[model samples]
Target: MSLNSNLARKVEVEIPLQSPSNVPEQSTGMVHRSISKKSLATRVEKMLMGIIMAIAFTLIAVSISLEINIASTNRALQDTKVSILNTTTINSNLQQEVQELSRYDRIYRFANKQGLKMNEANVRNVVK
Candidate 1:
């Protein structure tokens, strides 16, 4: 047996590939699954957006109501302050009038005008 025999040389093996016409339809299931996943994701995103909008609207309503309440309370406080000041001013005026009316000299002049005579011996002092 000679080592230089051409017919006894080693041969390379080749694997055969399938052509487009011979290939099986395995991508149909994958396409259906991808479409379903996209639709499900879209629905979830829409639901989340609606929930966020609802929360924002609720917060806005609450803030508006709080502002109205604060405004009303401030108006009431201002009215109360004005009323207290007016009452104090009226009370001081009444006190001054009372003091003027209770003077002894003024009372004596009124008595003389009424033809009343003063008798010092019968004068009475009353204390309250």
Candidate 2:
């Protein structure tokens, strides 16, 4: 044989093999686990979230109540303004009637019709 064939023979390696039965067996079954409770941090976080939600809801409720009160107050204020305007109009009409009734000419005519004689010395002009 050639020198290359001798080198190829030296490079060949052999190893022993085992049967499948000789390998270790592993169990394939459902795993059993105990139920676990929530952690303290998780419970605390949930409690804080609940409190925040309650506060937010309370604020919303209060705001709604305030808005209702404000609307009612505004309506009341408008009604008061309308009433005042009506009263002012009535007062103006009454003042005009008083002025008309207090006129010297109308009073003089009524007095003459009533057969009342005017005494110039007894008449006094009052200044207000």
- How does residue 50 of candidate 2 score in lDDT? 99
How does each model score on lDDT? 0.94, 0.86
- Lowest summed lDDT window (length 10), candidate 1: 1-10
TM-score of each: 0.66, 0.68
TM-score of 1: 0.66
1-117 per-residue lDDT for model 2 (tens digits) = 877554546455787798889997754431211112345567788999999999999999999999999999999999999999999999999999999999989999999999999
Report residue 41 deviation for candidate 2 (angstroms). 1.9
lDDT over C-alpha atoms for residue 29 of model 1: 87
What is the per-residue lDDT of model 1 for residues 24-43, given as tens digits with 9 covering 90 to 100? 77888899999999999998
In terms of lDDT, the best-performing candidate is: 1
* Count of clashing pairs, candidate 2: 0
Off by over 4 Å in 2: 1-38
